[model samples]
Structures are given as C-alpha cells and as structure tokens.
Target chain A: MRAVGAEEVAPTSHPWEIQADGLVVRVGGRRGRNAVNELTLRLGRGVHGLLGPNGAGKTTLIRTLATVQKPSAGSLSLLGTPLGRATGLRPLRRRLGYLPQHFGYYKRFTVREFVEYLAWLKEMPPEAIPGAVQRALEKVGLADRADDRLKTLSGGMVRRAGIAQAIVNDPEVLLLDEPTVGLDPAQRLSFRELVAELGQQACVLISTHLVEDVAAACTDVVLVSEGSLVFQGTPAELAAAGTTDHVGDSPIERGYTALLSAGPGRSGW
Target chain B: MTAHHPGEQLLRQYVRGDDVPADQLWAVEAHLESCAPCRGRLAPDPIAEQVWADLAPVLDRTPQMPPARSWLRHVSHWVSPVAGPWLAMILLVTAVAVALDQAGSVARGQISLVLLVAPVLPVLGVAASWGRAMDPAHELTAATPRAGLPLVFRRTVAVLAVVVPGLLVASQLTGASLTQWMLPCLAFTTCTLALGGLIGITRAAITLIAGWAAGIVLPTIALSRTSVALDVAATPVWAAVLAAGLIVIAVRFRTQSRSS
Candidate 1:
C-alpha cells in the first residue's frame, strides 16, 4: 500500500485537540475512591499508545475520552469543545470513534449492517454512508465478509468489524481499548499499518498491554498506573529510560517495567 | 494525461470544505490518488489536506463486492435481533387468551386473562428491546453518538409496533373495549420506561408486571369480578398516569445524557 503524504498547513483553529486538566474519574459514587485520579494530559494529532499493568486505569482513561463515562472532577475538552456541556457533546461525538475493551455486537447483524448502523449513529450524511462504509470495510480487510453474520465470524474477525465501525465515519479522534486482543500476528501487522495511516491526521489513542504494538505503531506513549500518568514520550524515549537490570525482551517492554518500578514521581518524559 | 480535468470551480469548492456532492467528491478523490499534478493544484488548506489524507488510503484499494441486500439491513436500526421471537411470543399468548375467552371462561363474570395480561406485554417487549445485560453489543452501542434515550425510544417504538396491532386484534376477537386495555397498556409501557431510568428496564418490567399481577390480576381472578383499574371509567386515570410517565421519561433522559 502507498503511504499518503502528511499535510503541512496552518496552525489549528482549536487551541488543543484534546485537553484534560486535573481529570478525576471516580468509579462507584461521588465519594467513591478514584479510578483515574488527578490525571492531566494534552494530545494532538498522532497515534498514542496507552500502556499499563492490569487495573492500571488505562480503560478508565479511554472511556473518559470516548465520553462513555463522565469525569467526576476536573475538565476534558476534545477538538476545542468542552465535554462538560451537553450541547457540545453530540458534535464531538460525531467526530469520535471508540472501540471498547469488551466490544459488543448484535450477533444477528451482518458485518455490513453493523458498520452502517454505526455510521448512522455517528451522524454521517446518509448519502455519504455507502461509500464510506465500503471504504472502511476494505480498510479493515473485511469487505469480503461484509455479508456474514457477526455470530458466524471468528473472534479476530469480530475485532476487525469493530475497527471497521470505528473508522467508517473517518473519525477525528479514535479511542481503541485492547483492539488487538483477538488478532493473530498478520492481522496485528495490518492493524499497525492502519493505525499509522489513521494517525497522520487523527488523534488515535490505543489502550493496551502490548508493548510491542506500542513500539511498532505508536508515535507517542502514555504510561498510566493506578489512574495516574507515569510517563509520556516517544517509543525511543521510553526505550532510553530502560536499564540493563529491567526485564523484558525488547527495549520498550524493559522501559515499561523499569518505569512502573520507578513509580509515580520518576516519569522521565 | 487527458486534458479533461475537473474544473477549477469544483476544486475550489472541494478545498473550501463545501459539501460537494458525494459522487463528485468520490470521482475527484479517485482521480487525485493517481494525478499528483492535480493534487498539487489544490490549495494548501489544512482541512482539505486532512480530508485527502483520510481518503487517499481508501481510494487506493479495491473494496470487495457488497453482499446481497437484506431486509434486515433496512429495519435493523429500530428493531433488535430478539424482537421477532418476542413479538411471536406476544401473538401466541394473545391467541391462547382469545381461545380461552371463546370457551366461556368469562361467562361467570370473571375478567379475561388476555385483558389482565395485555397491559404489561409491551412493557416486557420494551424491556427486551435494549439493556446492558440483554444486548451482546450493549457496550459498543452505548459508546455511539445515537446511544441512550433516543435509541431506547426507537427500540420501544419497534416493540410497540409489534405489540399494539396484536393486542388490537385480540381485543376485537375477545370483545374487550379497546380503551379498557389500550390505556393501561400504554400506561404500563411508559411507566416501565420512566422507572427504568432509575432501575434497569428489565428490573422495571419485572417489578411492574409483578405489581400488576398482584394488585389487579390475582384479585380479579380470586373474586371473579372485573377490576376497577381496567374499567372504561378509569380511562382518565390511565391517561394521567401515561402523561406523568412520559414527563418522567423526558426528565430522566435529560439527566442520563448529562451524567453520561
């Protein structure tokens, strides 16, 4: 596949593509303990891999970005629109695509129907949907299987269908939580290429435990643990933080281990 | 290259981020993917560049032939996968009630079972329409822009579409006054949605069904007398309850969207 040239243009009209200031998300109740506590980050157009151990609040952060969960305290703004206001949410949602960790599907729905339904939900122009759905399914390598019922698909195919729906709108911001969980090696490679293509213009945040995926596809990395940001930098930068004593086969994996052990206060980025 | 290139007017409109017709845009994009000269002719506007950036990769590949069109594709938005079975079940229940009434079960002045059960059937359908536990795609559906009360209402409408007609037919056959059953039926459905905003839809349906059975159905059966709740004289009360339930649902929708 050909690589599309990156655009060089004027500064964006929006001040920040995605801005989070002292974002605190509580899991259970108003007084419930924090799931994501006092986490602050700013992201612009690129592929960002969100990494952490299990129960590290990665999913919480992804959910908050996806607007599936409201922030209990602090603020979040996407594409220059504040999430707190109800009026701005629909428009923001129009440009947002999210694939949750436990992605759900209507088992009886064919692949084409599933993606088309999501395109409608994202408020795509009805006329533009057919072409867009065609493009999205092709991009995810599911065009041939578009008519197959979701229940008939294998686990990896279902994940690809999830991706097809996410990209059908040509979303400005895409949040994918554990999107690669079911894919084999070849599919993972194609996914990396897809991410690279999407990242050229959109802000793509992927929450996963795979350091290799982050190393291969992500332009930037954010490490979170216990609902707090531990590190933020390029894969090379993360790899540089690793020491000989750290565990894992790859530098990115070692860096991840090293950083988590170094804990909250010692983020090098 | 052919001299028959797209006009400057078209290029300008495309660059200005105007809503170019979809076919025109598709043709232009397909051409631009190969013709770097034409791509260069386009202005350096960031938004246009971004649109092209997103479109170029898609234009390069050959999409597989779309499958044969299915009827489910058209109506799947409002009606869920489980709706057909639920509707069939409702019809079956209605048929059984009609048969029982035809056999003179109500000759002794007892209320018909169909009349007793009709009020909550749609409520059960609405409950089955959408829920976290019921839909396999619930989380994915919830994340979409169209998720929430609007989607819920659409599914409810689908449920009612199946249910109301069946009940109307049953009422005609069993000689039950349409007002006597329709009012309570609508009231129960709206109330289930209203209460569903607090508890879940499934729970709300169960609670309302149980309440209706205990408070009205069981007593009517035991006493072998018509229940005041289903009488035509109680139409005003049922209408009032329906209105209140609608109000509650509207308010709850606002709160739910805001919180989410």
Candidate 2:
C-alpha cells in the first residue's frame, strides 16, 4: 500500500475491475489468417454496449471476456486475476455470466433442467440450486413454463431461456452476445428491461448490432470496426463524433457506417 | 394510495399459473378478469409476461453431468450411434460362431479373428470420420472456459464405453474362454480405442487390415517356424504397443492445436 498522502495510491485495497491489455486473435487457417486486434478495456458496474458491423470481432471479445476463448496475444484479468491461469477462472466463473450469440441446449432438457445444469456448472452449492433456478427464471420471466422441454419452446422462448441460464448465478460480470436476436418485439422490450435492471448490480457487456439497444439501455458504448475499437464513450459523445453537417435521419447509423469504412488513421472508424 | 393494478395482479397470476383458464371455468370468472382496468395493465405487462413465458420452459430442462460426465456424454455421442449396432451384430455373430465351434465345424482361430475384428470395423469407420467431422460447425460454443477439451473428452468417453463392452461380448460369444481371452480382449480393445482416437479412423482400419494381411501372407510365404495361430495369440501385445504410441500422438496433437 502506498502512503495515504500519495494521489496515485489506493487508500486501502481495491479489486481489479475486468481489464484486457492488447489482445490479438487469429481465426481461420493457413490460407489467410484473419487477424482480430482488440484494444484494452476496464469496465466497472453498469451496462457497457459493444456495437459494430458483422465480423467486427465483438463476439470474439465477448468470448474472451467469458474465458471461453483465449487471446492469442494479450493478458486479461477479471477481479485482479489473469484468465485461464488454473486458479483465477474457476472462482471468477462462479461470478461470471455469458450469453453467446449462438447458444444450444440439450434438446431433451426442459427449461428448468437447463438452468439447474448451468447452476451446477456455475458450482452453486446443492441447496441453492432450486432457489437459484427459481430466482433466475423469475428475473427472465420464465418461471411458469419451466417444466416444458427445450425442444418444445419457440425460438424466442429459447433465447429467453438462454438469457435466464446466463444470469442464473447472479454473476458480477455479465457478457451477452446479440441476446435479443430472435425475440419478438415485446420479448425484446422485456429483455432490454432485464438488461437495464441487471446493470444496476453488475458490470454488463451487451454486444449487438442494434444501435437502439445501446442507445436506450447501455451506460456506455464500445464500437469495434475491423477488429479494432474505433470509439468508446457515452451516447451523446458518440453522436457528436458523427454529426458532420449536423443533420441526418439517424446519426448513430450514419456515424457507425462512417466509422466502419474509414481507413487506418482516420478518427473513430 | 394505489388502486390495485389488475394488470400487475393478472401478470403475477399468469406467472403463478392461476390465470390459465380451464375448460370448466365460468365465463363470469373469465370476464371479471377481462375488464378495461385489467386489460390496460396487461398491455404493459405483456412484454414481461412473454419473456417469462418463453424462459419458463428452459428452467424445466435437466442438468447434465459435470466436466467428467460431460466428457463421457460427448464420447457416447460418437460411440453409440456408430458402434452400438456393430457391437450387437458382433455379439450375434460370435454366438453363432461359438455354437458352430462347439458343434465342431468352424475352426477356433477363424471364429476368434471374426469375433475380435468384426465389431471394431464400424468403430474404426466412425473414428476415421472424426477428422472430417472436426469442422468448424462441430465446434462447441467458443464462449466456454474449457477450451474444447471437455467437449472433446465427453464425446470420446461415450464412444469408448459403447465400443468396449461390445468387444467383450463378441469375445465371449466366439467361444474364447473368458479366462483365456479376457486380458487379451481388454488389451486389444484398449489399443484399438486409443489408436482410433489418435489417427483418423480410416488409418486405424487400414493399419488393422494391413497387419492381418501381413500376418497371414508373410508367415506362409517365408515358411516361418511360428504358425499364424501363435502370431494371432500375440496380437494383443502388438495392439498394446500401438495404443501406447497413439496415446502419445493424441496428447501431443491436442496440446499443439490448443497452443496454435
């Protein structure tokens, strides 16, 4: 600990908020390795939205945060511990939730069964399994149909169930990848509400192409284009960066497209 | 003071399963629930209600075994479909062959080879296809922390469990006395399973066929002192050696893929 008088010192002790320092991953193979260069980010509580075009590596970044895929070249820390180092992730996993863009469940499993399974994977104590299942189902509004098998559920319902499982453990950090992709309008609204509510207690990272979701639900935005983060700021700040002549139907869309197309040195693309 | 929001109450009722109207329910009861005040509340609550309705089904699903179980299950996925029927057939053939051998018609050596190698063919075929099946689509959700090992191991375990038992039954049915064939059967099965795991199933099959051909042809052509029957008895030892090598290769390949 540094002296109390020192401005650089943390007064007592501080936990590391999630941090990523210079991540690089190459997907595909020898024909031509597609390089994804990810910038560093340290996020605290509230909803942080990751927005970008197709193949922007938003999914890759989310997977890395979830510890599902390792970064080819970088160090990532969750709560002050490096990822995949035998010790850190196991415990951190108990406090982490992830919703992949494409999720699959055992077709034979019922909704309740899937969540219970996830709860088990999350390493929740035996006694808390049922309660956790109930609470998570209630939060996602799935308690009633919990007895129905997954194969019987509609696509939207499946997606909702996926979200419920992701949040079942009440993770401190929740990473969602295109979570509302298949939802009906009403379902999407409820999911957005759930994200907003969950954000109050945890650091939630929502990765999606929909600007409206980021605009309405997220506290901040991280925009990635061609595997690089082009911008990071609030909605207003993001809007300001795109307002050229100051008149457009939807500045967010215009700005995002502009950013995606801009070459090496240009700002925010 | 807040007026009871009928919609909120209804939404809660729906979640609780109380609002699901039965065939015998009174229209009055249903109507009491459909008033404008209730309807207005239900409109805003629909989104939440729908979300819960959708997710409720997922909560009913079952939990799978942990990492160990998962590995076993995945292995079963590969093994069961391809190996199960073949094992059953092998057992049936072995029973018939054993009956014949007991009746004193078929040779012991021929019955033994058929019983041992027949069931393994299907497993070898499926195992070889694994290399082809290692497509990007078969890849599990990359969002998991396990680095695909759990997924790969699960499939492997399930396959081995199915294949091993089948081999044992076939050996018994071939009239190979349990006391005589048990250890060798185990050794053979272990070797083949490990080899199948390492090289593509196709290569394992080719190796098996080539070994059998060489065993029969080389001794005959060279007029060797050792009979093919004796070489057959020593087959288990060869499998054990091959299995050890495959294990090493599989481990190295797995580590290399992950690091790359």
Task: Give the per-residue lDDT of model 2 (tens digit) for B157-200.
Answer: 55545445654565565545443444433443445545655564
A4-52: candidate 1 lDDT, tens digit per residue:
2232244467765789999999998656778899899999999999999
| Best by the TM-score measure | 1
Which candidate number would show the highest DockQ if scored against the true structure? 1
The 10-residue segment of model 1 chain A with minimum total lDDT is A1-10
Task: Report the CAPRI category for model 1.
Answer: acceptable
Tens-place lDDT digits, model 1, residues B1-260: 56557889998888788999999988888888788889889848799789989988987574434533657656777887667788788889888888888786664535787788888789878888877777777777776777767788988998888888988998898889998889899999999989887887889999999999899988888888888888889999999999999999888777766754
Report the C-alpha displacement of residue B219, candidate 2, in angstroms: 13
Candidate 2's TM-score reads 0.64
Model 1 C-alpha RMSD vs. true structure (Å) is 9.0
